[model samples]
Target: MNLFTDIRALVIDSLTALQSEGALPEGLDFANVTVEPPRDAAHGDMATNAAMVLAKPAKMKPRDIAEALAAKLLQDLRIEVAEVAGPGFLNMRLAPDLWRGVVGAALEKGRDFGRSSMGQGRKVNVEFVSANPTGPLHVGHTRGAVFGDALAALLDFAGHDVTREYYINDGGAQVDVLARSVFERYREACGLTPDIAEGLYPGNYLVPVGQALKDKVGDSLLDKGEQFWLEEVREFATEKMMDMIRADLASLGVEMDVFFSEKSLYGSGRIEAALEELDAKGLIYEGVLPPPKGKPDEDWEPREQTLFKSTDHGDDVDRPVKKSDGGWTYFAPDIAYHYDKVQRGFDELIDVFGADHGGYVKRMKAAVSALSDGKVPLDIKLCQLVRLFRDGQPFKMSKRAGNFVTLREVVDLVGPDVTRFVMLTRKNDAPLDFDFAKVLEQSKDNPVFYVQYASARIHSVLRKARDAGIAVDDATLKAADLSLLAHEAEMAVVKKLAEWPRLVEIAARTNEPHRVAFYLYELAGEFHALWNRGNDLPELRFLQEGDSSATQAKIALIRSVSIVISAGLGILGVTPAEEMR
Candidate 1:
């Protein structure tokens, strides 16, 4: 039902006909031949570079090839006009019936209209928001969570078996800090003045974790040394922190299919198995890494260590697997995690990380490449920082998170839908400004509001039509005589609607869910444009007084617009509004 795909297939069929007629070479490659909307709409409805791309290979003039192609394409009823533009670019205008048919297709498909098989059921593992289980998630993690979740949804819409995953950083020094922080809370719960030291977590959220610890053991570790309580407290505190994180994610409508833990990798021989896989390929070695480029860590020492031969797979240098003290480096488990994903038989992998972790991108890709022997592709999307603003001034602080703005705080102020949409209004690698005032504003400047308002406006039209006794449902709309929708403005909306399935595949293939946001905004813009025109032109309106046939056609068109809008928002994890509150 994708109009663009249907048209492109027509173009390919015509080209094959041209080949059969001896106008083109017997074995001309049409891979580069593309049919898309012309940059300047004034030129035509759709443009193709078929003639231009084949001219050089076929040893023919561009205009000569375009002229023959245009003549052949015009034979199809779907194409009304096919003409050659500058340098033999063939611009073709489709018939009004074709655009009208797209509306019928949308009404028939509903929210599933744009769903595609671009991914071909390939298994994909997307690991994102793998924050340390030391504390609750903060604003920094929110962007990653939203981006990753949206990406998984987009791929799912594009037909991938996507697994939403979170890799817990529990094996790091951050969890050790969590152990000490909880010990203070445990003492405070026991009626003892707790030492809230400088290096500890002082958030009120952990106060309950401390209380829970007292209830579990009745202050058995009261006035005890770190040796006796550290291990017991660390495990208890990590569980509580993870619970808080899960609740925070639920508040934002994000749920992970897998929560792979780094600590689990420690004692379970998973890390050993991953390294062994690498070792079997001779990618593991005992070597000393050269002094790192740029300013080195103060603790950087020249010592022989176990290293992964990542340089063989495009890394700048080999990276340490185990530090000099025999403890695994942070990179070790990450490699193992990717190895596990590859072994799980995913055809593709994507990692979402903060901008500060840019250096890890190359090494992680190298590790996945070595692990998969380049059989699978890995893409890492680094989300830039989000700067929150209130009243044009930078907003900061989190009473619960101690210093950073927690994700729960952002979701509390603005519901999960607003938070998620605003986070995606910008590219993943670009800085985003989350203005509290602007986002909630009902004006068109707010993209979330703009998109939701369009959906709401559709319901408004439906209600108006229903009160007048005009039966309104997708099944009726699809069966309506859509050819009655012959207005130029109505056709423009149909053209925009035709872009959805193509847009979904593009966004999924690029692993950029932000593209979906941008596309939805643009689609909503066109819808609003047509809705506004109805005020000046009564015949252009969805409801035509005393003309049931025309009204049905118009309703089918606008109803299709609503259908595509809902599907686009669904991929973005935003609720399509029926009416703005």
Candidate 2:
């Protein structure tokens, strides 16, 4: 149960009773009232803005409303201390038994302890890791993969119907470049000195693709011109690259529910259908855009282009849907793709793009808004670059990719768990540094290690308790007398555990999965603090020397910590360490 939500409901019920009794106005809006953790823990367990938000509407002084509300709240046994803090803010201290019950609830719920129904089963399409089908995914795409996967998992835990998808960039000119590059490798496979052109992709990862092409066609297409092999080779090479990409994502434990192809939008009537819908809405027009923001207008000449009235929604300027040559611009396919998602009946759409695509955000949002007639909302999250370091210096580029570190290279070096946890340690839009030495270190400085170590500690305690002939199974511990867990240090950990469900809703609502990582780190810290306190205070020790009852209470508390940690790590796509070597 969410204590914060429970208390908020209590406050709402009290306010409604006040209105029924004619103590307050009958039609006042209470939507703005909120119950949240007190900014300062010492102030109280929870705080509410009911009085401050309702004062003017009720035509009553803030203090008077707060005093009346405090009286109503104090009647509940859960709230031990209800007092007015600043102006009209009400802070309530919950009874210790209420905090102890959180541990029982966590142990009973296990990994489902923090699961929330915040999304209410709304359908959400999370499209991420849409890296071009050009070569192996790089470290930049790795961040998006982990972030998007974790976000999908987070939303699912928060009760959203999430679909993880990947969009292939096979329809673009880059795939043509890839075809030419693969053809060079194919020439080398045929015992010819292949020319490694400067503009072509020079990564050696395509050497296998070249050899595979030879195995398939047996030199049938060799010595052929662009017209004869370009289309076939482009299709063949894109499939190979996508196979390699799927393998890369699998190595990191990511799977896509859909792999949309940009080529599918072309040659089909989908692009026309999307644009026609916009045209019917009077959003499509023919116009020449002003010179690009920072470019010189002297070299810019006006040309009539098919434009979308993106500015009418929220964009800085209208965007071109088709170029002056009447060919579809890059933005056209993207608009059609989103329109397809809307037609598929997604309540919400989220695209995880690299930071370099930040300029496309506003126009994309505007297009989706116009297409959905404001019925659906689209959120675009940009993942910034990742800098790699090893041995206190910049890590060398991949020998395979030849320019950037591949996702497989990072995963092979430190394993996928470390790669993912470290990547999410920073916000999606913030640049992250992956220090090879620091991340694998055993110290608390490594958040991944620290959090996993907390789970390891719990397992160790359970083993020690079992060895002492004490029952430590979840069912037994859950039925333990939690009232015996009254130490201040023990209560601190339980309080943090109580915030798990609340934290889940907040993180999911903000569309930020990094908050889960941050919260897990903080929870681990509190747990470790309690464990260390046991070293000095014999009474705080989880395993009492002779008292089985006291030991059971402490075990219940720590076991609950492990349950929440596992739940948090599960959302992050990380497996909790049962034992750390």
lDDT of each candidate versus the true structure: 0.90, 0.93
**What is the alpha-carbon lDDT for the whole of candidate 1?**
0.90
Query: Which pairs in model 2 have colliding backbones?
Result: none
lDDT of candidate 2 vs native? 0.93
Residue pairs with backbone atoms closer than 3 Å in model 1 (clashes): none
User: Where in model 1 is the C-alpha error above 4 Å?
Assistant: 295-300
Error of 2 at 95 (Å): 1.0
What TM-score would candidate 2 get against the native? 0.99
Best model per TM-score: 2
Q: Please report how far candidate 1 places residue 32 from its true position, in Å.
A: 1.7
Candidate 1, residues 1-581, lDDT tens digits: the string is: 77778888888899899999888888888898888889999888899999899999999999999999999999999999999988899999988887777787788778999899988999999999999898889888999999999999999999999999999888888898999988888889999888989988888778999999999999689868888888899999999999999999999999999998888888889898999999999999998877868997888778999999988999888899998889899899888888889989999999999999999988999999999999999999999999999979999687777888999889999899999999999999999999988999998899999999999999899999999999888778878988887777887888888888889988988999999999889889988999999989988888888999899888888888889888888887888898889
Per-model TM-score versus the true fold:
0.97, 0.99
